[model samples]
Target: MGDPIKKIELKDGTTRYRFVIDIGRDPATGKRRQLTKTYDTKKEARAEYAKVKHQTDEGMFVGPDKTTVSAWLDTWLKSTTVDVEKATAANYADALLPVRERLGGKRLQDVTEEDVDELVSWMLTSGRKRGGKVGSGLSVRSVQLTLGRFRSSLNVAMRRRLVVRNVAQYTQIPREARRKAAAMAALRVPWSETEVRQFLASIRGHRLHAPVLLALIGMRPAEVCGLRWSAVDLDAGTLSVELTRTLVEGEVEEKGPKSEKGKRKLPLPKPLHAALRAFKARQATEAIRAGELYERSGFVLVDELGVAWKTDRFRRAIHKLMEQAKVRKVRPYDARHACLTYLATSGVPDVIVSAWAGHADLSFTKRVYIHPNVEHLRQAADQLDELLG
Candidate 1:
């Protein structure tokens, strides 16, 4: 019931109006807390005062909070896990680590565009968390991911009234960083078809050939590792991709496909089907040889004793096979890239290629997975010549 409006005279003899409202008790000290608003005109002062009072009375008040960026990141992560898979949540945490390390102590509301921009620049220069030459920054892709995740968290903060705007809204990855990323990707192109055939020949009788072929045939390394014998139907010559055992924090964890489209049944290519049959027979013999010691984990990719392979192990196996085959090594995931590229260029329909890659977006599959080479371009030129000539 105290006086809510007061008039103040400034040193220049100008008058200003202010409204003061008592919010509620601060639980920490059991003291009354008041909110104040000042405006040049009495009308503006009255409007804000009425708004605050209504918000306070209606339990819609969002007062100043001092939640630090680091603390709120933790809260946001918990909220994130509810909406995304655990592996995705872990990836988000990895992306936000730079924010936590550099700006975590700052109040979330105080984060500015300059702060995020500087962080991005620093990440491009010195953000490598581990294992790089001194003064070398993280990769452009990693910095982009960090900035994106921070922007997302800030969006949540704005919705919760913790901040007025996303500080990272206008931030951008440096041009040099993007160019560098593009150049690096160009240098590390996936294996060509000749290399693919050579690698398969080299691994023909190898113990891990079946699993590596699964990767070469467009299955993700995690999917290859997670695939179970029960999910394969040799009689039907089809394989179901419904489960994935991916790594989170260096530990293997099982989960379902990332999306509904990802949970598809792909017809097994003939070579893959034959490889699987041979591998299955070999595993049966191994199980008999190991007797009670066999793990019988039901996974298709296993060791002599039936112990299943994880992504890292499967990746290493693929690399060793590549080296032995005299083929250049690429990341295991690139096998999927090569497969998709081959599928796209071999006259496979774009929609079919997208579905084969387990992606709902045809554009994404085309943009990211399908890489056209000079020979492909030459073929297009030949067709154009035929049309024009």
Candidate 2:
């Protein structure tokens, strides 16, 4: 605290009020920090000074900031959030790259709604990178996720009184962008039942057949990679979902399931049970044959060396196998969608299907995971044909 207000004569002989207050020392550099304000009249300066005093008294005052968006994001990811997991923080750091590139240099308090609005437009147009291409527009979904995380980060800023409001709030994706997203989604069609059967036939008796089959049975790739031999009981014909191993920029990181429901026990189908038994025996034979080289990592998805498979490798392997089999190449996630769609179309109960997919919300499981092709809707079309006749 210092003098609340001081009247000073300007060069033009007019008067103004000024005040300076010691905020605190910068924790990073151990340098002193202060805030100085000049006002057109004593009354205004006194009012603002009182507000500052009240804030200080209430333990809500924030020091003057030289913090830019990038710096704040770095610090926030590292130190601000106590509950955020390392992988999630890594994702947040990644999602905010466009923000850092566009607005990182601006003072944290200086960013306005207009600036954020421009950022939204830029991200949806030519600000994103895709598939080795530079300056390609991001999908509308990607833009929405990036901005959603940005808005959450800005909420923390607001709580600290760094800004009076969230400058990044209330952003909406344009209709044109939404239409483009729909078109892109349509082009990424998942495999139909025939394609699924072809893929299964192609991967039959392969060393990684069991793990690949898990994906076709609605297991997330992370779940498949994370599975260990201990979680599977061939005698009981059950496989438990316990942990997940995911890739963070090419590094394998072990973590728990996404939710409580994600940790489930699924009864193995006869074919999958046989596949696992054969794979387990093969792995044992290889381990014994190459005793010194065997790592014995205990993971279900591993190479001959016993090292656990990460998602990227698994995804690529699946794609290669699809090409070799002459089957349409769809993402492993899309395979999970096809499986869920199959269950839904084949009269599986909605709750049971959701549980099998390790999802808490039945509607979400159906809406996001179930993808039906024209063949799947033939029954409805047939019924309509009869009705019209």
Candidate 3:
């Protein structure tokens, strides 16, 4: 018979390149059989061929399965982390969409390291529109964030035995350092004591003065407007900030404090305490005489009919007060800044000052309230002279 179609092999020197199938026969049945095996080298290929011959004598063979990566990735995103926030999900979809076209047809096993690298390169060089601007190149931070989300998805796939390994494990983006240099230039511009005095004097005849004073004592505008007479302790001189009201979609509604720390009870300033006490005495006298005709709405700062003060009305009141007082036109919120800046400049520790400003971190208080100026320079020089002497 022709030389039995023996195991074939291709190789270079000591390195094995490929494996071949060997055609053999089953002597018992007088039937033909096909055999296949792998090799370490061409010399070893001969040995492997003999091994295959031996295997055919027995029985053993396996083949690789082909699965496309793009198809797998689609399944991965849908199954894993789909419950992430809406904004986060949108970000993930945006990052992976363009790359899907490039990887769509390739088998999961066929996608090489080069393919992942090329996609990253393309994402960096390409222009992306974000925040009202087009033609802005992707930031390292943005690229890294998106890739991290992708890696997490792939890691889930790996756990499911969908892939042998995560190709993105070795990949990284060149991230820029978080530079807060602009904050160094930031300055606290609070209302001056004189301006505040003038404002309070101007609003004396208006029904909004008490609320304005509540704001002056460092209570947030929403807190002042939302204050209920029940929560105010005229005897103890305190205001409980349990609930605050603000305009939501153009209509006023009561909402929780912006943060848990914002729900703190602030000790009323002397001026605010005095003003509120006077307001209470006046209101009580008016209510006693008027009886049921005195519309009591449970609000501390309210209109003629005892309704909650609107933001626009509050702003207009402040503006009118400013025009009458002829003080520098600063926003009503300047009162809060005035309180914080006064504390910082007066040498109050940032840790304690931050609490009153409703800041969770002392560093934030320092950043917003502590500013360098000629006064700071003078104070430094004056204080250092004693030590130098």
Backbone clashes, each candidate: 0, 0, 0
1 or 3: which has the higher lDDT? 1
Candidate 3's displacement at residue 71, Å, is 24
- In candidate 2, stretches whose alpha carbon ends up further than 4 angstroms from where it belongs are 1-7, 11-64, 78-80, 129-131, 384-389
lDDT of 2: 0.86
lDDT of 3 by residue, 196-247 (tens): 7777777886656677777776777878778889998878878788777776
lDDT of 1 by residue, 1-389 (tens): 66577899899999999977887766458898898888998888888889888877976666778999999999888887787877787889889989999999999988888899899988888878665785688888888889888888888987776776888999988787799899998888888898889888888988887888888889888889889999999999999998899778988899887888998899998988999999999999999999999998999999998888888888777787788888898999999999999999999999999998899899999999988888778898999999999
Q: What is the C-alpha lDDT of each candidate?
A: 0.88, 0.86, 0.67
How far in Å is the alpha carbon of 285 misplaced in model 2?
2.4
**How many backbone collisions does model 3 have?**
0
Q: Could you tell me which residue pairs clash in candidate 2?
A: none
Q: Which stretches of candidate 1 lie above 4 Å from their native place?
A: 1-20, 23-32, 36-63, 131-135
The alpha-carbon root-mean-square deviation between model 2 and the true structure, to one decimal in Å, is 3.7
